[model samples]
Target: MPVTSVEKDLNTLSMTIVADFASPLQRLWDAYADPRQISKFWGPVEWPATFVRHDMATGGRSHYYMTGPNGERSDGYWEFTAVNAPHSFEVNDGFANEDGTPNDMMPSMKMKFEFEETANGSRMTNTATFGSVEQLQQLIEMGMEEGTRSAMSQIDAVLEDLATFAAGKGTELQILSDTQVRITRVIRGTAPQVWDAHNEPELMKRWLLGPDGWTMPVCEVAQEPGEQYRQEWENTKTKERFGFEGELLESAAPYRSVTTEKMIGMEGPSTQNELTFTPVDGGTLLTLVITYPDVATRDMVLATGMTDGMETSYLRLENEVLASAE
Candidate 1:
């Protein structure tokens, strides 16, 4: 998680930043390939960005805008010059008008992104070449150095989300049965690592919470069939508590498990959960199926924004547990 360097070369009129991430190279490449993922961290934390249109191929055009804190907005565009998946891509990056047209008044830079696999993880080098020293200095004065650094710092979170939603790991909700719904994700780790994260209470406390400022004060797991488990969390500020207790119905370490779950404070019949972990392309494909009493119960849970909340929690699991697992 160390940023190796951010350097500028006046002679070459280029700016470069090098950073390493504890993620696979494909996940890093995907951050640029998917526009929805790109929008998550494409701008500085203070000035969030929104992508109007994105086409990630050679000669494709990407139009986006970043809104400043004062309601001001800056539009930008990227014309892809070359694309080599999971390796490198080149683009002409510059300012754009509100109508998604290039603005002639501003200077454009030829930007290239290169990804390389390292012993620790993946290394990314971003190089932006200007036409002249003056142009480089102009952009430097415009806060490009600091702004780019701020934006790049958010890539770790994006990578985590990408790993979970990688190819074939559909984020789309799927109805499995009249009383069941399923969602699958590809986490960046082996089967054992994923199993540990689910069974180990200490690890569960790190990512299972729905949102920030929530702490899991009680996480007890009995990893044997017919054993009972309970997890409880509370909002630090409001002291609002929520949790679920369950009995392990079946246990097959690092592969599959089935459990019966009941929310402590919620009014509903206990649900059945089946989790299967399969190894795929050096990662773990986790399939989660939850069966409620009826379709109305399943739809009711979905309407509470549970999908988004669960997705967020899974992303945190990828970042905090899977990515760093040995």
Candidate 2:
């Protein structure tokens, strides 16, 4: 209903759809920037999406999958080529394999999304350019138009539910698959500040302690890729101590980081952790995606009160570290 027009230009081998929404331009832009909000309506009603990774920056990539009614799944990916923020962005969109690699057998397209503020609300222009006429016709035959319409129709509900994704919601855990889990929390601080808090030893020791009785004794942060980092925490009263060490695999300053983590002194497969910080309406949306060695390891980690402890640490970060900065 929000769609005003859907045009197919055979000469240019492109398809364009323009839709109007009853929300501010920033709100509409944020819907796409935040993975949690975008996943809610990125697929057809029957095929809900789960975005395991979303980095809204140039050269960044997003990985998501849509699940069908009968448990079928279709994976997709987007490589951001240009990101102008709140107005327009361009990406190379394509189908992906189960391992999150591009499916070259399927046609990929150059897609651009433009947003603007209208008198009533906002408008979004989505244009996808195919390599050839045959490719465009192929996607059209694959129910591309119908699927997009269904996806856009569900965005109204997500736009109106503003408070759900706002700040102070605490740490949220989402199981993306048997091996992957995503933890999200809106920290009341800027992305740079939040990133620094995690990277700086002094700042981390001030807030990374889980509970009131715990104290961080050692806080060694990895400054760059291939660098090893270690952190140790102790129960102040009981004198119990434990630690974790990891080598940084990737780093993008205030935006994203990937690392391999293992409990120090333990012998087992390590987990891969991907962290991303995105600026939102309230503050920074900190997302951590952890891939365990297996389902058993995933479930075991969750059963250890990991989420609750994370929430406590995040709260301390807001109150002690960020609040002091303000």
Candidate 3:
């Protein structure tokens, strides 16, 4: 168990947990920074977590849910108040509704996580401040302390599993649920460079083409929130064309963007795509969470070899667009 100590102060209306890890500072930090690794241990062993949106920056928000053994789910949200990279971060944590909004009936708490280099490896101090002593007592009675202990106990496994989430793994896909999926890849470039490749029309046209035979003839990029963008591709030999159009719902430059996407002529519900970029050890970690309208729609889309096509485009982005810039 990595948890060294747990403290609760009624006078201060706070609880603090300190945990030490054998992994290096960056490794410990990455375990939390990367959603793939964090999702493995954020919740207790019995109630595993699935993060749909994790933006680890100031003014950002994260939406995740824990699934119980019997298919029950408890949603949560984190509003990041401060982020100092590998050192520390603070968030307002609270229960969330299915629609990713805060639940006002449930009490929210402020949490600060501080990381530091220890003699053997690293240490993380987590402090949660409740609004009132009654709130603190209520959470304690609800097994918050025990739950946190169990959650932190599982982190050791995630921290040591370096090979699984490391760079060069190519594009990886995780079916988060029936209606949501997460796609992640580590591109060989900085976050800004990767974000530019995604937003700049010229750069996107060069590398966003999924396969070798496809040419992006029309690339109308959206520069801000509420703006609609269109993308079309044509086969080189057959000239067969298809396109997608969407409105940018949210934009956090160089870090995150959320857009609603749909086939140009299709008459069905659209998908909300949330993209996040984080600077990692090797390069930039690009995570895209797509929320489908239903299980049937998700399955239909995955049947089209979407992940494989995405991998091809990512490889091209690294080699053809980013590498040439170097």
Cα lDDT tens digits for candidate 3, 1-326: 99999999888889999999999988888888899988999999889998888999899999899999999999999999999989999999999998789999988899999999999999999999999988888888888999998999899999988889879889998998899999999999998899999999999999998979999999998888999999999999999999999999999989999999999999988999999998878888999999999999999999999999999999999999999988
lDDT (tens digit, per residue) of candidate 2 on 1-326: 68889999999899999999999998999899988899999999999999989999888899999999999999999999998887999999999998778999998899999999999999999999999988898999999999999999999999999888767678999888899999999999998999999899999999998878988889889897999999999998899999999999999988899999999999999999999998777788899999999999999999998989899999999988899999
Looking at model 1, the pairs that clash are none
* Alpha-carbon runs more than 4 Å astray in model 3: none
RMSD of 1: 15.7
Q: Report every candidate's CA lDDT.
A: 0.80, 0.93, 0.93
Which residue pairs overlap in candidate 2's backbone? none
User: What is the lDDT, from 0 to 100, of the residue 11 in candidate 1?
Assistant: 84
Native-vs-model 1 lDDT?
A: 0.80
Q: What is the lDDT of residue 198 in candidate 2?
A: 89
Candidate 2 residues lying further than 4 Å off, grouped into runs, are none
lDDT of 1 by residue, 96-200 (tens): 998679998998899999999999789989999999998898999999978877887898888776445665453455664478676666677877898899998
- Point out where model 1 deviates above 4 Å: 162-326
Each candidate's root-mean-square deviation in Å? Answer: 15.7, 1.3, 1.2
Per TM-score, the best of the predicted structures is: 3
